[model samples]
Target: MSKQFDLSVMDGMDRREVREYVSSLLWQLRLCDGFWFLNVEKRHGRAEAEAVNGLVWDKMGDLAARDVLERFGPFADTPCGFWKAYEYLPWIPTVECAVEHDAPDAEGVIRGITVTVRRCPAQAGREKHGLEPYECREMHETEFRRFAARVSPSVQVECVQAPPDPTPPEYDCRWRFVLPVGAGGDR
Candidate 1:
């Protein structure tokens, strides 16, 4: 299989066609077991987005190697883009979830409990009265720990970082915690 494979073989192919082909291939490979979800994020531009969509189509055969059913992306609007590609390959069961962070901390078991809070910058004159967008900056962390305490002692807390944006350096930090899969009592 390695000898017959060429990573760059799809460079000249129309992206929509390539995506359809890959979707078909992944469906056949599923063997009626397991699920696949492709998550596409908001893209910055059309060309770069198309390139990533094409790249996903080009790399579909390698999904088994990556051990992930979902492909996260900032995809394009072409027919072979993430949404259409997923629709074409509906047999594989795809899901779209917001991509919270580039790296998620899952060092231990997950309990399925997550808490998120947004912190915003204080206006120039608001500092004197201590008025801020959020009541407590450490609220997320405190809530995470409180949720963890309710879970079984055997379960471990999984800390996942929230997405970061450079817009507000002083006030835009978000935090999340994933509880052990079944420990938190919900999906």
Candidate 2:
């Protein structure tokens, strides 16, 4: 049996022309990397976290290997640059929830960007399914770090808070991105 693939499969945008649409598309845009992960989780449930995360890594790693980001990414391999570039991505922040960023922690002990996601759409969706929001901290740590490395190997990421942890009412998750002194990052 053969399978049929339809252009309408793409979130309702009828892609009537394949060649020109692809030619004009920015393949390394980075938004799909996030959307794919969420869609898999939504369709398969939280148990899919590990699998979806691994797949995201595989896809993202391939981008790194392709030298793809150089053509489209605005990130500069610096903490500030990562946040600035990431914040501008249109759908990710909108789909996930508005993210709040704090650059350079108050003590100045780390020159990095601290990000907060107050209302994660994924978590809300899972909760609606009567499923406990699965743990995503570890998976996201790998995914985000790999994503940053694709832009600039010097960028580092840590998930300060994620699901399965008691998310404070103010935020659902928090992440910190840093460029250590040795990595040509600000001291």
Candidate 3:
């Protein structure tokens, strides 16, 4: 018979243990990504490494979106709904982030949301390793667009600021998710 393994291995853990385990996994995931890029850059070059990274993130965005909708669907096809799903993306837990939604208008229509990254673990890691900052705007734009479009075809993602761009002192990066007028409401 074939052997099967799954998260049932964690069934016996206490809540604290589970939380710790998840935190460790997130760190491992981030480190794996960082080291992978480093090795690729070493073997090939920065341009090729970044190109491959972009492709990987693009696919990850699509997969994450599909999984989010499958696991937590029936969300409104609006900006707020997209934000709800976006919050569940794995990377969110790996970094410090804050999300602010625009107050709905009199008609209860929310048009947009602002997401700010308070601290980026990747950037911190690079700084610690004495590596230059990664210029990630293009990759992030593609990733966000793919993820948001998957959630709601009309949803639009705009980058307010990201690496390679001058960011405000308080935040590392910022993004805006918006729904066009008449898509959800004209607010």
Candidate 4:
């Protein structure tokens, strides 16, 4: 059993700091399965405040996979297809980071950062609930990416597959994301 926290309440912090904070919180809560989605709101001077979900933060991990969720805070309320019907997953605190980007077309834009934490799928499923093997497997390799043509624009994020599993259907995987981080908007 782990205690859950919200990101909406955490303001005035950078991403790395946030990650350290959340890591401490998770370690304290004894939570093995959880994830945080960081939603950054860009404003004058810098990106302003945002919100987070406590329940949604807890159920995004697999032993065979890395349980990291990016770009989630802003869309906490939005309906997500992946996390539709799971319970006991606690949402935890998130960290914010200032990203510096420099591209050919665009330069000197500030981007807010967010990181989500969770347990590996298999362990999470077995300990919290009896999840099917296939479901846990799907979560392991699923790649999530968001792209926009305007505003901050065109960021690609995904979970990279790990080495193939020797065990019949099991697979190894890793999470990866490529977003335009600096002055350049998108390249």
Q: Write the per-residue lDDT of candidate 4 for residues 70-158, one digit (tens) a residue.
A: 32312211112122111112332221112223232334222322222233443343336553222222333321222111112233334
Q: Poorest 10 consecutive residues of model 2 by lDDT?
A: 1-10
Candidate 2 residue lDDT tens string, 128-186: 76867767776667756666765656878887888768888787898878777656643
Alpha-carbon TM-score of each model against the true structure: 0.22, 0.61, 0.90, 0.26
Which portions of model 3 show Cα errors greater than 4 Å?
1-5, 185-187
User: Model 3, range 1-187, lDDT digits (tens) per residue?
Assistant: 1133467758889999999988898888888988998899889987888889899989988988988888787566777777788888768898888989988866788888899999988777777888877777889889988887788766789999998897776878999988877676423
Over 4 Å off, model 2: 1-49, 61-68, 88-91, 96-110
Residue 142, candidate 2: C-alpha displacement in angstroms? 1.5
Judge candidate 1 at residue 1 and give its lDDT: 37
In model 4, what lDDT does residue 38 have? Answer: 16
- Which candidate wins on lDDT? 3
Compute the lDDT of residue 4 as modeled in candidate 2: 40
Candidate 1 TM-score, true structure as reference: 0.22
23-100: candidate 1 lDDT, tens digit per residue: 776656542321111122133443443345445444542342122223333222211222222333433233222223
TM-score of 2: 0.61
For candidate 4, the TM-score is 0.26
Number of backbone-clashing residue pairs for each candidate, in the order shown: 8, 0, 0, 42
Q: Judging by lDDT, tell me the better candidate of 2 and 3.
A: 3
